[model samples]
Target: GGLVHYVTWPGSSRLLVSDPAALKHILLTNQRNFPRPRQQMSLLRKVVGANSLLATEGDTHRAARQRLNPHFRFANVSLVFPIFVETAHRLVDRWSKLIDADAAGGGAAIIDVHPELSHFTLDVIGLSGFGYDFDALASAGNPVTDAVNSLLTPLSLFVLLRSAIPALNALPLASLRKEKEARATVRGTVAKIVRKRMEQASEPVEK
Candidate 1:
């Protein structure tokens, strides 16, 4: 697909497309000519915090890609379709109830869509990615939800800063303290889930 050039500040570089043909020319046609740009690496380091598919390049990236590819196979994804459908149906049912309630109130009741949409998206992630229903969409006062809502503003600014500086991220293991703490919280939660899944998989299945 073709990409439109984004008009932005003078010093900032415009977005790079990396279209299939462009990707092929850089990757296979001139395999040894490619390297991960420093600018890209700096942005990836903030969230992932180390050598990730975004941060690494060459054989290291290729090897990691191969290793992770199995997790996304068509057969594996097919197994999870039912879980996704159930979550979607739950969302629809919720909206239907709100509509009914509004009708009872003679169309005078105001329904808030913003918070419900956010919870719906987050719950979808929990269901599809982690194979657990977060139930954030069910009602008000979901305790774990405030943690996610608080990060939105800072996360956007951090991503922008990462793309702009591209060198400050290269300073080995140092970052703005608040950003670092946010990154730690997100990554730590992911790590805990990984450990839990690994342990569960290792245990014998109970009949």
Candidate 2:
């Protein structure tokens, strides 16, 4: 218990780990001994696909990581470096516009940077990962952005109760219905992007 301690919740207890060596042992050296909690996996799979690396375990996770490793290599990552720079400039311009509008109204602008940063992150991921432009910084009403935001909404008491009692998840609550729709929107959008890429790959290249 040198760097680990137990913490109890309403219905369960879990270890709070802090030691770096112990963490490495649990996460990398002997990962098989520990598995992600079912509740955590279920929540992640709802957003990221069942087969995604984050939702899978053991050999499946390893294989998924290997498949994605090439895309994270130095050369491949550098290919998307321009996207990062361009997105950053867009963020700056957006902030500048806000500041200018505030000044025009004769008041100092107090900006909430969290949502802006979130938009920047989404923009980068959409462009670099999927070759899709979320344009989250330019506008807030994009369907893809709306879907992603819905998934990020803060958990309510109903959601907490559902997690504690899995049976409640089957109830016909409006929040649950909205969450299901959001999941569908995210899944469908990603599938369309993937299908387009597959079709492009199958096309004959000009000599």
Candidate 3:
């Protein structure tokens, strides 16, 4: 119905229009012409991967989506149901222990469930998607979990600075330094896993 202009950075205008026709035209018809901002894509690539769908465009984006769509289908997802249930049970067991520990220490102890849930979700992703047990909920200070947390942490002020002045990313801030370290850790861990998988695959099948 109306156009809204937001000044995300100095001397720049980001538009948000409430017109359905305009939205449809931009999102559906002219999407290729209006790709994600280069800075946003570059930042996302560092977190996800160089070949990540979030950072890809045009034919590469289409090909990646097409390849991933089958594995993400409801039917395919159903195949991981057992893994999901097992993870869920593991989460419950961990929580039960926490509650028991609290009860033994005091009558009623306040607990923060956010980190527990975060670890549970990460464990689920590791087991189901990568066939690696992160065991984040079962153990504290898991390197993979710590790496992911460091990389994906939301820095509100840093985000605004990065978005407004893309060059700020080059500055060696504490958050940026931590992110670099986390990325290295993730790369090393994934490389090790990939090498192991390759070695296993090359082994002769047990007859």
Using lDDT as the measure, the top candidate is 2
Could you say which candidate leads in TM-score? 2
Tell me the whole-model lDDT of each prediction, alpha carbons only: 0.69, 0.84, 0.81
Q: How many times do residue backbones clash in model 2?
A: 0
Clashing pairs in 3: 1-18
* lDDT score for residue 151 of model 2: 80
Could you give candidate 3's per-residue lDDT for residues 142-163 as a string of tens digits?
8888998776666576675686
> What lDDT tens digits, residue by residue, belong to model 2 across residues 1-207?
546556555556677787888899998889999998776777778778888887999999888889999989999999889999999999999999999999999999998897778889989988998898878889857877777888876666666666668899888888788888888987898889899989998999999
Candidate 3, residue 42: how far the Cα is off, in Å:
3.5
Query: Which stretches in model 1 have alpha-carbon errors above 4 Å?
Result: 11-40, 93-122, 136-178, 205-207
Give TM-scores for every candidate, taking all chains together and pairing residue i with residue i: 0.61, 0.84, 0.73
How many pairs in model 1 have backbone atoms within 3 A of each other, for residues 3 or more apart or on separate chains, i.e. clashes? 0
Instruction: Give each prediction's root-mean-square deviation over alpha carbons.
Output: 5.6, 2.9, 4.5
lDDT agreement of model 1 with the native: 0.69
Candidate ranking under TM-score, highest first, comes to 2, 3, 1
Deviation of model 3 at 12, angstroms:
9.9
| lDDT at position 200, candidate 3 | 84
